[model samples]
Target: MKVANKNIVVTGGGNGVGRELTLKLLSKGAKVIAIDVNQFALQETFRISGKNPNLLIRVLDITDKESVFNFAEEIVSSLGHIDGVINNAGIIQPFIDLKDLKFEQIDRIMNVNFFGTLYMTKAFLNHLLTRPEAHIVNVASMGGFFPFPGQNSYGASKAAVKLMTEGLYSELLGTNVHVSIVFPGGIATDIMKNSDITDKAASDSEKNSKLLLSPAAAASKIISGMEKNKYRLFVGKDSKIMNFMYGINAGFATRLIKRVMGSKMSMEA
Candidate 1:
C-alpha cells in the first residue's frame, strides 16, 4: 500500500524507532498521529517535523483500554480514516535471569509490551475493518524468535506479540488490512535503558553492545515492510540468526540463545 496521502498512527512515537518511522512516513506524504507518554519527546518530535500541519501528537498510555480506544476514536474523527496502524509502543524490563527474575518485572513487561499492543489493536479493529485497504504493523523483536538469558520478560513479551500478530493475520486474511510483523536486532537505540539496568556494571555492558544500524535505518526497513505488506520483517544479522534457529525448534533455540547471549556481551567488549 502506498503511504502518500494515507493517515497513519504510530504508537511510542515520542522517541527511538517510533519517532524515526513517523518522520519517514511524513516524508512519504502521509498524515501521522504520534502517541507517546513522554510529552517532552513528543514536543521534540513535533519540532523536528518543522511544524507540519499533517502531524498530531497525544500523550497516551496504551495499557488503559479506554484511553487507547478513545484516542483512536479521536483520530478517526479528525482524520476521516486510518490507513495504517503501527503497534510500536513497548517497554523492556530489567535484565534478570529466570532464576532471579522478579515477578513484578515480568508483569510490567506483559502489561506494556503485550497487553498494550493488544489493546491498541483491538481498539482500532472496527475502524480498520471498515477501511478498503489498511495496514497493521507490529514491531516484535529478534528476542521473540530466539530466547536469551537475562531476557525473560522482554523475550516473552515480544513472543506474545508475534503470536498475536500472526493470529490477526489469519483472522483478517483476504481483508483490506494487511498485517506485518517486524524483528529488529541491535539497532542504535535506548531499549537497554528501558531494561532498567541502572547499575554501573550492567549499564556499561549495555552501552557497549553492538549497534549494527541506526534507528532511522531500522525505521526505513520497517516502513518498507509495511509498504510491501510483508508477513515478517527482519532487521540486522541477529534477526537472520534467530530466523534460522526458529526453523529448528523453539526448545533447542532457547539453549542456543543462552549460549549466544553469553558470548554476545564479551564479544562486544
Candidate 2:
C-alpha cells in the first residue's frame, strides 16, 4: 500500500532512520504516530519536522506489552484506523563476546529488540486487519542473517524478528496486511552510543568504514520497500553483498565477518 494519506505508526521514531522515516512519511502526505522511549529525541524529531498536524509524537516503551496494547487502542480510537506499522525500534548489544556478556544484558537486548517488535505487531495486528490494505515493516539487520562477532545476543534477537516477520507474511498471504523484513547493514547512526558502548576506538573504526549507509538513504529505501511490499528488503550495498555471500557459503561468510570485526574488539567468546 502507498504511504500517502495513510495512518502509520513508527516505533523508534525519535532519532536516526526512524526520525527520517517520520519526516519522509509526512512529506508524502501520511499521518504518522511516532513512538519512542525518549521524549527528548521525539521532541527533536518534532522540531526538525516543524511539528505538522500529520505528525503525532508519543513516548512509549515498546518492550512493555500492556503499554503497547494500550497505545494500540489509543491509536484506533483517535485515528479511526491504522493503515500500516513500521517496527523500526531496536537496540544493539555492547561490543563484547557472548560468554563475557551478563544475563541482564542479553535479556534487555531480547526484550527491546525481539519482544518489542512482537508486542507492537500483536497490538496493532487486528487494527491493521480492518484497513483496506496495510503493511508491516520490521527492521532486522544484516547481523541477524550473518552473525557479527560481538553482537551475538543482538543478532539473535533480530534473527527472531526476521523469522517471525516471514511467518507473518506467510500467514497473511491472502489477508489485508503485508509483511516486509528489512536487513540493514552498517548505517550512519549513533547506535553504538545509544547502546552505551564507550569504546571510542571501536566507534572510530566503524565510522571510518566505507560500508555505512546514511540514515536518510536507509529510510528512503525502507519506505520504498514498504510501498512495493517487498518480502525481504536489503537497505545498504553491504547488506546486499553480505546476504548473497552468506547464502553462497555460510561458513565462509562467518569466518570473514569474524576476521574483519573480531580483531578490533576485546572479548572472551
Candidate 3:
C-alpha cells in the first residue's frame, strides 16, 4: 500500500531506525504517529523533524497490552482511521550465554521483542482490515534465523516474531491487510545503550565495525518493502548474505557465526 497521505503508526520512533522511519515517512507525505517508551527520545525525534505537523509523537510502552489496545482505539477515534503499523520496538539481551543469563533478562527480552509486537499487531489488525489497503510490518533480526553466541534468548524471541509475522501473512492472504516481516542485520545505532547492556567487548566490537548499515538506509529499505507489500525483507548486505548462506547450509552458517562472535562474547564473560 502507498503511504502517501495515509496514516501510519511506527513504534520505537524515538531513536534508531524507528526515528529515521518517522522522518522518511513524513518526507513521503504520510501522516505519521511515532510512538516510543522514551519521552525524551520522542521529543528529540520531533525536534529533529523540525516539529513537522504531519508527524505525531506519543510515549507508549508496547509491552502493556491494555495500553496498546487503548492507544489504538484513541488513534482511530481521533484520526478517523489508520492505514498501517510498523512494529519496530525491541531490545537485546546482555552479552551472556543462556545458561549464565538471568531469568529477568530473558523475560524482558521476550516481553519487548516478541509479546510487544504481538500486542501491537493484535490491537491494530481489526482497524487495518477495515481500510481499503493496509500494512503491518514487524522488524525481526538476522539473529532470528541465524545463531549468535551469547544472544540465544534474543535470537529465540526474534525467531518467534519471524514466525508470527509469517503466520499473519498467510492468514491475511486474501485480505486487504498486508503483512511484512523484516530481518535486519547490524545497523549503526545505540542499541547497547538503549537495551541497558554495558558490555565493553560488545560495545567495542560494534563501535569499530564499518560494515553496519546506517539507520537511515535501513529505514528507506523498510519503507520501500512496505510499499511493494513484500512478505519478507532483508535489510542489510550482511543480512542478505547470511540469509543465502543459511539457506545453503544451516549447520555451517551456525558454526561460522559462533566461531566469529563467540570469541568476542568470551571476552565479555
Candidate 4:
C-alpha cells in the first residue's frame, strides 16, 4: 500500500537501511514510528530527520516478546492504528566456522534475526488485520537462500525469516495485510561495526567493491516494493542474480559461493 499518511513502524531505525527507510518514509509524508535498541543512534536518526513531526523514535528491544507486545499496545493507543511494519533489525556473527562458534553466538543471532521478527509480526498482526489496508515487510538476506561459508548461523536465521514471511503471505491471502519478504545483497552499511564483529578481509572487500548498494538506494527499493504490494523484493543486483543462479542450479550456486568466500572464512580446530 502507499505509505503516504500511513502509520508505519521500522525496527533498527537507528542506522543503516533502517535509518534511510525512516528518512525516506518521512519525506513521503508517512507517519513513521522508528524503533531501535540504541538510544543514541535513534537520536541521531531523529536529528538527521530534522525532528520531523511525523517521525516517532522509540527505544525497544524487539527480542523481548513482552516489550514488543507492550510497545505495540502503546503505539496503537497513541496513534490509533498501524498500517505497516518493517522487520529490519538484524546482526551477523563473526567470520568463523559454525563448529568454532559458541552457542551464545548462535542464540543471539537467532533471537534477533528470527525471533525478533516473529515477535514484531505477532505483536502487530491483529492490529494490522483491523486496519483497512496494511503491509508487513520482513528483510531477509542473500545468504538466506544461498550459502556463505562463515555466516552459516546468520544465514540460517534469515532463512527462517524468509520462510516465515512466505508462510504469512499464504495465510494472510485474502486479508488486507500484504506480506513482502526482501532479500538484500551486499549493501554498503556499518553492519559489521554495529554487530560488533571484526573481519578485516570482508571489510576490505566491501570497501573495494563498487557494486554494493547504498543504504538510501536500498531503502528506496524497499518502499517501492511495499507500495506495489510485492510478495518478494530483491534489493540489490547481486541478490537478483544469485536468486536466478540458485533457481537454475542450487549446487552450482553453492559451489560458486564457497569457491569465492571459502578462503576468507576463519576456521578453528
Top-down lDDT ranking: 4, 3, 2, 1
TM-score of each: 0.90, 0.94, 0.95, 0.95
- lDDT agreement with native, every candidate: 0.85, 0.90, 0.93, 0.94
Q: Which window of ten consecutive residues has the lowest lDDT sum in model 2?
A: 198-207
Order of the predicted models by TM-score, top scorer first: 3, 4, 2, 1
lDDT per residue for candidate 1 within 166-242, as digits (tens), equals 99999999888899999988776676554456533234444455746777988999988899889988988878877
User: Which run of 10 residues does model 3 get worst, by summed lDDT?
Assistant: 199-208
**Model 3 spans > 4 angstroms off:** 199-208, 266-269
User: Which candidate comes out best when scored by lDDT?
Assistant: 4
What tens digits encode model 3's per-residue C-alpha lDDT throughout 43-142? 9999999989999999999989999999999999999999999999999988777889999999999999999999999999988999999999999999
Clash number by candidate, in order: 0, 0, 0, 0
- TM-score computed on alpha carbons, candidate 4: 0.95
Distance from true location, Cα of 135 in model 4, Å: 0.2
Q: What is the C-alpha local distance difference test score of candidate 4? A: 0.94
Q: What stretches of model 1 exceed 4 Å from their correct place? A: 199-211, 249-253, 264-269
Model 1, position 222: C-alpha lDDT score: 91
Per-residue lDDT for 1-269 in model 2, tens only?
Answer: 89999999999999888999999999999999999999999999999998788999999999899999999998899889999999999889887789899999999899999999999999999878878999999999999997898899999999999999999999999998999999998887887666667444245555556778878889999999889989999989889999999999999999998887876554534
Candidate with more favorable, higher lDDT: 1 or 4: 4
Q: Least lDDT summed over 10 consecutive residues: which range in candidate 4?
A: 260-269
Which is the winner by lDDT between candidate 1 and candidate 2?
2
